[model samples]
Target chain A: MSTKDMSERPTTVLQSLNAAMHRLMAGDSRVVVLGEDILDPYGGAFKVTRGLSTQFPDRVLTTPISEGAIVGLANGLALRGMRPIAEIMFGDFVTLAADQLINHAAKFRWMYNEQVRVPLVVRTPMGGRRGYGPTHSQSLEKHILGVPGLWVAAPHALGDPGSLLEQSVALEDPVVFVESKVCYGRFLTRPAELRAEEIRTARSPFPTLHLTHRGGSPDGVIFCYGGMAPVALEAVERLRDVDGIRVDLVVVAQLSPTPTDHLEALLQRGISEVIAYAEEASSSAGWGAELVATIEEIRASIAPRRSIRHLRIGGAHTPIASSKEMELHDLPSAELVAERLLECF
Target chain B: MKTGERIPLCNRDSSPNELYGLMFGIRTFEQSLLDLFQRGVLAGTTHTCLGQEATAVGVFSALNLELDCAFSNHRGHGHFLAYCGEAELLYLEVMGKPGGVCGGRGGSQHLQHRNLYSNGIQGGIVPVATGIALAEKLKGSGAVSVVFLGDGTLGEGAVYESFNIAALWQLPTLFVIENNGFAQSTPCALEVAGSIRARPEAFGIPTTEIRTTNVETIRNETSRCVDAMRDGAGPRALVLHNYRLGPHSKGDDNRDPAEIRAAWDQEPLKVLRERLDTTEVQLMEAAQTERIGRARERALAAPRYEY
Candidate 1:
């Protein structure tokens, strides 16, 4: 197939992640995959790790239901010169592995004084569209964003998650690769009416994907990431078509390190009047709060005199209910995003 | 010894003098650390392997240091010294000097030198070592991963999880439990329940229990277990029923003075010193004392870790 045909072909986010694993395992002997039920036939809970065990049976380890040990074991493999991608069955279980990730994997290289490098990636699905209830569905990446040596990357459906997964595996530091569960079955194609450009920076390997209307500059900008991209895009379209309000959307792939340089550069490029930080997690102390803090810091230097209107949008503080209606009501939606963006204006 | 030099395996044919020298060196190094702490020359806590020297010296001496990986806990001075014999570098590391093994960043509890690693947390290294063994198994390297845990760490749920995975995967791992009768100040009676051997045995891992301070016996048994692991016999556990001669860290002894005094009779140094000649033992002691003194001087003279 030609490059254009391949790019235009409809691929699900799940397929992209699976292909990323296959490519990584095929190209590098050091790369290994380990998780519960990640073997052939089962392919994990979301099927993102499908066919990996059949392809690389020896390297693809189907571990017991031990979240802490799974991550801890991956840290050991990474320390001993192997590129290991460990899967926590769900993003919520990542709390069980927090000690291994935060204390051991993240602190190993620096604490060991550069005596070792942990090229480890921990992949997990995070989001609440299905009725998986309180424990299984949570956007807990915020808990680990403040870690000194760890990297956090969340790939959206519109971007190439496969390449982002590969990039995360290639990094010298340990990374928490958060995949949105809601985006698994979605097609990995950008909308035709929107123009997308990947903004690259030296600070992070993953690029920030900027999406805007085809012909005109947007009156406001909405910064979202991972699964929130689709919701934000829907909101953007509704704002433009129904209310005649044009708003651009920025989808961030790398959540940690705050992507300050990219956000600063975008704001400096005159895309700053009305902004909204939308996220799938809770609003208090969530990724949106961090981004708002970062934007506030950026605005101090870039536009000290001008008052930039901004709003933070996220899920409610209560535990996500199992009912689909309540779940949708709790989480950020297209209508909510539009209403919040109007508030920003 | 130079960095990355192949460490000689301690076996039956190895000299008693050499083995004694290793155990004695560890004892001396830890004693010097205690002295340094008392003089306010060292910051942070130090877990001395004063009475448990035989386990470290014996277990590390048996493993092929070039390929095998060893994971240790907070009381890891003896293990580090036994694995690499880098007393001077360890001294520098404990003193927070730039010339230390991990550039003075790891301080006393955390250390990494080639295949040997250590951390301060209890029971966390179990899964880490199991994972290393899994890596070695995957690479077909025929190397066994060994982890040292105290009696106190048996209560951690992660240890059991690691035991289950190590047995389920048949990874080449050896879990060495140094049951020094106490976890910090809590006795094993208060912390551990049932038989410790039955724990790993429940996971289908064959275990051997040794209740001696004899370095030779411990070394011989560890070698046997390591050999079984190399031959793909799966994970094994070695329970060393030893005692802690010194306080847990610094001046934190809660045990009876009589118990501590009685345990000194079975200390590795005194036990091994009985086998050697009086003149030879005296000469070895003096040499180790002077060598350790010089290491401390050099470590003190070295500049502090900048960052």
Candidate 2:
């Protein structure tokens, strides 16, 4: 019984989130939805929460335009034996709730010596595409990576966001669920003519879809997630078609408490060079930097015999400008990934 | 008390004697901490609710202990002790012992026990209390949530946001602003604009002002407001106009000595003592002092929490 023959249809990222909320609330009465403008008729800013408040009138709460209060409110609800899904509207606004999210929610369990479990999911759209300027258009999940005791889940383009979101809600710890703004309307992709088993395996929870070219060991491996997955795939195709560089791809679904073991296993599969890319604003402590550190640690400890070279592709350190040119300059494109892949090889 | 009737200054269920006991316990505990800090026994300094005992004690007296939750600010020792009545845990937590409520991870400013929570940040718990009330409302538990904030917290934007949402949703929440006349060194008059009630009242929430340190009056007003909330009357604000007789924190007494001394006359202990017989006052004071002394010894002797 090959998994490829399962006949599962593709779904948009928005549909995945909506379906996840419906299923979560339907199955568990404890799950609640709260955010600004999330009530029916208004939905949310990106309409990800459309029809949710209407379906679950009493459970879904429409909060005021207060990110700090909204997050703190969710923390309170979670502490009081309720599973709360709080939406921050935009990822950039998470800065406003940093104190509650980082100091209170993240440390509550540890500080309280496990007297409480903060089972809350904060869903917000991250990454740039709508020219939302510096504040609105940001992959702010990078800032949340270093926070202790907080889990971060970012569903990739090929992965099932609904399944991941459900997992996040059921988790016993606080989670920051990041949905890519650009990926919301895009359809999940599968290589044409692939077996149903291959597609099913690729969509499995935390599965690393390694797409190799030339039917053998790839020249390099690229790691990415969310909106960057599609761009990375396009880069893979271009590298193989034009530059004759056969590269492999390892798209991650969970970023924080990163799937380091899976990444180490992928690296151990004999690709001598790897490239870690992120759409977040570049810094010394960016996600790409963490990935590089993990790669180096894994290489040093586990696979020292076959030392691999690593290159990181992250956003520009400067704030994203509203203009198209500067926006383009700020974020990494598939062409840039392709060029970087070729140069690294 | 009838549905629309106001709670009298002293009622059968108000338990003025027990409330007085709790107030005395809070004061004794705080005074012991001050002594401990001076002797270098307690590591970090604490913000004592010296002059604000009646505000916390009165409000806590009105709460349904089985259902209600409270969120307190930096001056939370009084609230935590008044609500939970666990003087030993508070002392142990301050001493960073394993037997403490939070296992010594959360010191004075971050004490949490059962339904009571407190943090050092101003206005941070306002929304958290609203959320707890919202949860209770959804669960059909008829429970009310209370938050104790200072006049200093009025400057935070989250406080107003919490009021707006709590009022809009009709959450069973009560916001008690301990207008201690000063936000640290800055006087409330200089920091706050207009009135403390104006902000919550703007959101259509009912407001009550209690200008005295009379625990009986505070208990009556809070009981009325809490009852209204239990009857689905949304959020209410109580401005307990009191003064901070002590400095904000240890060794930070920036307030005028004359003003501090003047505010001492309004101490709740003094007010309660005046109403009681001389023998009754002496008995209550002696009992509370012995209770705190024993709690301090136990807390000090408690084994340290190994991290």
Candidate 3:
């Protein structure tokens, strides 16, 4: 099948990811899956690795509860010419493997003077909504975003997450694939009237998904990604319906290396007058901050005289509460996002 | 005599002259590094395997370089020398010159040559080595992966995690613990509790404990272990009890002078010298000195690694 048809085929975030792994393992013997309880009868905590072990029992490794070892082992495997995808059951547990990821896997390529490539991927379920409490629910991709030689990718439901994951696994450097926990069951569909364009950068292989209205010019632009992409899209629709405000929503898949060139080009084209950066993670020193900084720098360089109103929409600066009401309060809601986007106007 | 009491004479594939030459080469190369550091010719720090040359030489002698791979730790000059005998490249690397093993990016701690890899972080390479073993096993490549660590690394949680996975998965891995009786001057008594062998043994990996600086003994035992691993005996652990003759890095030694002197009596070179022909040892010494001197001159003449 052609790449276009395969991507056009309908798939949920979970199904897309599972099918990608299945396709990768079937086509390439070098690709292997390693994680805790990722085998048959238990397809991992999120079922993203379902049927992998059964189909390729020898290649699929159901590891012990050791996140650090899992990533470290993946690094070794990648070093030895095997493409390994290590799954951290919960994104919060990624902290356990931070040393290996940050120090070893990330630095191997450069530290070894490009003699070796660590084609390893660490995929995990992140974000808060299911009331799994403080530990299980977190958008912690921000912590690993700026690490040199490590690629951080968080594909949204609207884009081809499976293709992004495949691209990530095929890269020579190590990548952290951040899968939003709440978005697993979400279908990868977009409004018929909305137009989607992918913007690629020289530094990164993952493309940024640019979503806009079919004909009407947007009053403002909102940048969001991962689980927050759906929320941002909802906010855009609500703004148009209630306040007659048109907003363009950009779903970024690659979070690291900042995609400065593509973002600079977007700003230069003047996509919208009022711009807002939104994310499910906390606003402090996060994706929102980095994007805002990039936008500000670009705006300052190109159009210093013109004024562009900007605002950052993000989760509350506190631990995500377990209660449904409190969790809703802490997280960014469509109404809250729309209300905040109004401030930019 | 105790395991580490004296160097043992054994009939092995490598002659005594070859073993002594390798050990002497490592010792001189390390001493040159110290000399270069004192003269400000070398920058940054280096962890030399001054007192632990026997383990590197012994374990590497048994390894099939074509099939087996090794992961080394911070103190890895000995292992690097024993595995490939690339003194010129190592010199270029330590000197931060071009054409080094890792293009001078890894410096002294991080090095890669063929199937041998070294890292500065303690206990981090254990899992990496285990992973390599897993890859070899999956590939059906009758190979064994070996990782060298200090007693200090036992404190790291990752080492035990690697042990658990290696044992659980039945990977053909050899975990060699070079217990030099100190964790950068803290001593093993203050850091390690219970027995080191019991740590891996608890994970169902059969453990072998050796307390000697004898390269022949280490080579023979490691050959047995590697042979078994290649034959699918699963993961094995070897606890080699030796002593550190030099400072952990540069002039950081805080141990008593008397104790250092005591360890010198059992140093691998001194012990092995007694078992070899005096004339041959002298010739090997002259040859190593000239070889290393030329490597140093060539490395010094090489250009610095450009960005």
Candidate 4:
């Protein structure tokens, strides 16, 4: 009933995701799996899609290296009353399919006056660790935020993933569901239900949407999302131990639609200037641009006196370095966050 | 009559003439669009489906109202109207006004409206439509996706990529190349190196080549493709030999209109009209014309698509 009890049993993030996919496959015939190296033998590059091919060999489709084809195929399938889940081997590899996403699926609904329902999910492994540098380490959230027809998802917890994943499939729109390579091992947390209900509702979280721990304090707030959320949380620990200044954490599991309501409230509660944005993407786009733009808009609308500051530490220009230590230097890590926090202090 | 055992595209008895009437409807639909273009109401350039109307109207006829999906190119109003009931929004789209399907942002090239979607980029909609076909196949709903591309699109690597997947998986898709003889003034002869059928057949798909001018031929061949896909036959390719009445767009008129003019001399539309009994075919065709005439009057009467 309680999250404490749930984590007592050991399980990998892949197991939880596999269970969700299994349950989803049972729930609807429209559900299909697609990706490279996803078959009876290898499962997938990281074993995430392992065993899927065996159970639902018919539904699990193995595709070629063409990113455009994979993405376009998913879009077409979704339009034909089927729920398709497409996987790009690497998050960086999806750039090759930009034509289908940025052009077709994303704009279809708006351009066509809601005549087409792009009910498909694109799931990929993103973020850096183990030296996957520039190309591999990129967080493409900003690039997609501007697209009108898509629903963006970045599930940071195991239990929450169930509801999020279910909702993503049911949504009558295209979705980009991302999983961080680094945060996968951590135990997932969800709410406790009573002795009766199956907890059938997929929209709301267990009880409250917020989770409180030593991870909560409000000297300042760090609003980060995707792979960078955990880093921001760790940066809080670094700030308190080193600078003796406490900070609060607000991680956005969803990037698009920008969570305007939650963000507006956090800033209103007497937090200092906001941090512009982070992660390994270009400066002109992504959270950095919208993060600061939101701050500026709220400042003008709510408080004229307050001003938010920015310190950006993102992916380097070169290809994602394969060497582990060099990879650490390539992405903005805890140290970079500590530096930014101290400068603010 | 024989292009070597392969059925000649101009086989009159092989196609469905009634379907030609519908393509005629789609043809005038394109003409209406062109008229709007000439009036400066519709913005951007378009690839009109004038001579290729049979392909759109005929193939679209094979679909179950909401079951089948279509992907179109820059030249796309005919395909857009093939699915009934949203013709007004299309008018709004080309007009580039607020009421447009994409709220005017997509304009002509990015035309879409739910299940019926299309893009202007060459070979852009091909792979995407093939994906839709794959989804239909996976869902087991017997749904199919049809992509209408120009012969010019053969140059894109993405099209070839989708072609491989569709044929390999036997996804329920049909790729219709409106071989309008020219890809923007460059004849297909100048652009393509080999025959169209051999290209797709090399990928393990069954290919059908038809002369779209003969509506009956278009209807029969495409109907077989759709039925075969729905029955789990995988994918099929349709290569249409059609010609444009004018230049690629409104500006270029370089063609020696002689062949087209001679073809028009046969008066296909007039002949179809004659074949119809005075009551059934004549009434329907005339009524169709009358309805469109009134539509034109109403369209011009309405507040123009202009700001």
What is the per-candidate TM-score for chain B? 0.96, 0.94, 0.95, 0.85
> Docking category for candidate 1?
medium
Candidate 2 i-RMS (Å)?
A: 1.1
Candidate 3 segments exceeding 4 Å error: A1-10, B1-12, B305-307
Q: What is the lDDT of residue B215 in candidate 4?
A: 56
Looking only at chain B, model 3 earns a TM-score of: 0.95
Pairs in steric clash, model 1: none
Worst 10 residues of 3 chain B by lDDT: B1-10
Better of 1 and 2 by DockQ: 1
Residue B160 error for model 3, in Å? 0.5
- Clashes per candidate (backbone, < 3 Å): 0, 3, 1, 22
Best by DockQ: 1
What lDDT is reached at residue A270 by model 1?
73
Tens-place lDDT digits, model 3, residues A1-345: 011222456678899999999999998999989999998888899999999998999999998899999999998899999999999999999999998999899998898888788999999989998998788888898999899999899977888888989999989889999999999987778765567788996675688878787676779999998999888988988898789888988888889978888897777667467888888888888998898888888888998877777788889989888998899889998899999988766
TM-score of each: 0.96, 0.93, 0.96, 0.84
The predictions' CA RMSDs to the true structure, in order, are 2.5, 4.9, 4.7, 6.7
Q: Which parts of model 4 are misplaced by more than 4 Å? A: A1-6, A157-159, A189-217, A273-276, A282-284, B1-20, B57-69, B80-116, B256-288, B303-307
What are the per-residue Cα lDDT tens digits for candidate 1 across B91-193? 8889887778888889898999889999998878889999999989888999999999999999888899999999999999999998999988999998898
- The lDDT values for all models are 0.88, 0.80, 0.88, 0.69
For model 4 chain B, the run of ten residues with the poorest summed lDDT: B1-10
lDDT, candidate 1, A187-245, per-residue tens: 87777677778887888668998877767667899999999998998998889888999
TM-score of 1: 0.96
Docking class of 3: medium
- Candidate 4 chain A, which ten residues in sequence have the lowest lDDT sum? A193-202
